[model samples]
Target: MENKAINSAYQYAFIGAGNMAQAMMAGLIRQGLAPARIIASTKTVASSEKLTASFGVKAVQDNSLCLDADTIILAVKPQVLKAVLNEIDRQKLQEKLVITVIAGIPAAFYYDLIGSRLRLVRLMPNTPSLIEAGMTGAFAGENCSADDRETAKTLLQGIGQCLWVQTEQGIDYVNAISGSGPAYFYYFIQCIAKKGEALGLSYEDAETLAIQTALGTSQLCLEQSDGNPERLQSLIDQVTSKGGTTIEAIDSFKRNNLSAIVDEAIQACYDRALAIGETYTK
Candidate 1:
């Protein structure tokens, strides 16, 4: 299971061809990765047929068939991951680079299930990946070589932005922020729309307004920040002028301890991620 030399051109196999798996597959194909080099093993024949029809990739219901590829992507659910791993050929798995997008599982958990020599990378990618605008966090196992990291980065970048964290626990921090982060924004948008509805605007009009505002605001922050945190704060300050309507809303948020509430929510998410990992360890 020790790190071995891998070919620059990889043949990838996905264990479960779900939404996230399909996203990655789409990105890879869009970036010129040959669909013939990709294989997906889904849970059902219908799912397999759907993938083949949509992506022109080979698809099957047999998990064992995936081991023929040099790189394996574990895109299955956390609950079913153990079963999937158990069903795969362990010896073959040891020689391949395995990248897992299943959340709340540590690299050690995989090593324990497979072998310590297994080359593994744990990844957390958000839903935006479907549209190739994902934010992904990656952590490599100790046994992985520099090539393994690069291979992962190359494949991931096709989908969107990729960040490599130094520690495995950093993956949990990622889970708190970007992993569960999309739902938080959606909830905020929903709340805004609901408020507008209460204020006499139609639900459709209110939701459209909120959605556009959110999209424009995100674009503004990204363009203006230029990777500077302080610049982002400055952007916020620019809109919250003294006694302005924006300031009124900002004051109400502050008065209600919105910052602390968000902090608690993120912490809760982080804790739950760690707890899930702990469960697997035990």
Candidate 2:
């Protein structure tokens, strides 16, 4: 096994071949990591074969590859995490750093299950990661060294932007924001399209309009200098003409307490993530 502290070129492994795992793998592969340097595995040969075909990396049906790599990413769902962890004996990856993207699952929970002090990281990735514009939030474990964090950051950097958080509980907030955020956007788009249709817009036109509007607005926010968060209030002030349509919409949203709605949505996601880990423990 390569020393995770030192930057060995050939030291990456993924213990699950799921969606986010595949997204990260694609990001790493695109960022110039040799496919041969990374290995991935799942519970079955069929899954492994699919990953091998997709990424041209080593894929196996065993967990031993995880223990052998300098970095191991545990990508299984929270409910199946312990079984996945138990399937692989810890002595293999105990010294090797591990990164987990399971929702609502904390590293300390894994330590309690594995019964050891291991270097671990909790990662929360949004669904947009598939398109390479993801917002990923990460929090390090107690035992993770600076090198371990760099390994995690290096692995995630190419996928999108990364936010380093201070605590595992912070991952819950991440879950609410980055992890479950894309779905919320999609849901809003769907509702907007539905309303457009009800207002007599053709179905296809309404759908296209809703999708493009969201996309264009996002691009505007990203590309415009006016999108600065610190100047957000000033930006809004500039946008609102006296008694304008935008102000009417803003007043409607404020009357409905949109901020509170957004907060509750995020908190709900956080609560659910914690609940997922609780389900695993039971």
Candidate 3:
């Protein structure tokens, strides 16, 4: 569906102005959203002042002040989300389109805390959003209109790509893959760099090689395979010729059950996300 242009007069207010919120704020501004149309609330007066100075946005110490915005972004930590929700004037939020980047909380939890009238969109965006190369997973609540979903997608697109899922549970899967996935890749890079160091390469040189190779390989696969699993496997096979060193490494990884290890890790992440949601709802 073609996205409706976001009204320039629409005001966006972020409940928390931390790293992710700041990244989003920067992205929006870079995408031509005026700084005057954006507001942020920080925990302290000093931080609020810092944000206002740095981003040229309206910053406040009071969360209630954010209610005036047309779109409200809940960017707080999951642990503190309930407390924050409790403190806000829920009635004021009934008409506003709310988008949450907080993990592990479902729309039902918010409906209970605020009201059933709330319109919400849940997003799971990774750290790469700081660099305008992030992948975001989104889910619109039953209360949200099509325009609400489109607005959320448009806002997220400023930072990177946005993908909408069919159910809220899909957000948990997204969290496991794209959200927690960055650290997994970072860990793999570290492992490669460490092994290269042990093989007598300087740590800096090894890290550079590992990072560049990962970047190049990801770009190649994205361009050539379009994320088709069969094509991706074919790309891997291209480098894994019989009797080659690459095949030796591939055989060792397969013998070590690398795929299973990754599967288990993702399952653990998804389970933890469900547990957190359960904890909050209960």
Candidate 4:
């Protein structure tokens, strides 16, 4: 493998100035990467101005400038990705590392449109990245060098923890798990808050309790996860005695097939991701 300096020295260009892009840029800047080393493109002049002002990175309207960058982060939405790909000079990307945060599009789809020689990394980042507590899943294509993978991992780690998978297909699983996982937590938190409200707590109090409980539980899990394989299950079992209230709730969830419902929901997300990939690949 080449030295770390080789990978870390590359210039970054973001093709979209959206929330995820901004989150990544902010994280990089916070982690001591020079802001001037990064650049971004936005749709409108006003947006470009705002991005430049907000992040101190060069912002431009022309997407072609990104072709000159050593690393191009495709932060655009899936719907606009086709247009962006059509406009860019794919040949210019042959020597560059292209990292994408766009959901539902596989690395092979990009290679099919561009040349297969392009080094590519596909990523799925959740919303919590804005606050630096997110989880991202990354997968690199066959042509991607070890240095390219290292660079991608370093950039993503600035925002949150990143998990790398061997197969490109694993990206779709990441999409189903962590990418859409935050919304599942949000939905459950909403239900818990509502239940609290129904039980006579004020809305604000209920919401605070619900959110804080989530944070505390996650922290507890993190603290207990030091090589204890069954730590999470152990924690759950500890909370549920033979005839306790927790056991009653667990039994109710079991009777109602909650686990099956969650599995079905995750499967639905995975299926939709496959359908979207099929739509764009053709």
From the highest lDDT down, the ranking of the candidates is: 3, 1, 4, 2
lDDT for model 3 comes to: 0.91
TM-score of each: 0.95, 0.89, 0.97, 0.94
Residue-level lDDT of model 1, residues 1-282, one tens digit each, is 222333437799999888999999887787777898899998888887888899999999899999999889999889988998898788889889999999998888889888889999999999998888999999999999998887888778767888899999999999999989999999999999999999999999999999999999998887778877788879989888887799899889999999999999999999999899999999
Clashing pairs in 2: 104-273
lDDT of 3 at 204: 97
lDDT of 4: 0.88
Which stretches of model 4 miss by more than 4 angstroms? 1-9, 226-229
Q: Pick the lDDT winner.
A: 3
Runs of candidate 1 exceeding 4 Å displacement:
1-9, 226-229
Which of the two, 2 or 3, has more TM-score?
A: 3
Q: Which one wins by TM-score: 1 or 3?
A: 3
The 10-residue segment with the lowest total lDDT in model 4: 1-10
Q: Which candidate leads in TM-score?
A: 3
lDDT of 3 by residue, 53-162 (tens): 88999999889999999999999988888788788888988779999999998898999888899999999999999999999999999999988877787788777888
lDDT string, candidate 4, 1-282, tens digits: 322332446689999989999999998887677778888989999999899889898899999997877799999978888789889888887678999999888777888888879899999999999999989999988998888888897788767888898998898999899999999999999999999999999988999999999999989988887667687789889789996889999999999999999999999999999998888777
Off by over 4 Å in 3: 1-5
Query: Which residue pairs does candidate 3 place in steric collision?
Result: none
Which scores better on lDDT, 2 or 4?
4
Error of 3 at 280 (Å): 1.3
Two-way lDDT contest, 1 vs 4, winner = 1
lDDT of every predicted structure (CA atoms)? 0.89, 0.80, 0.91, 0.88
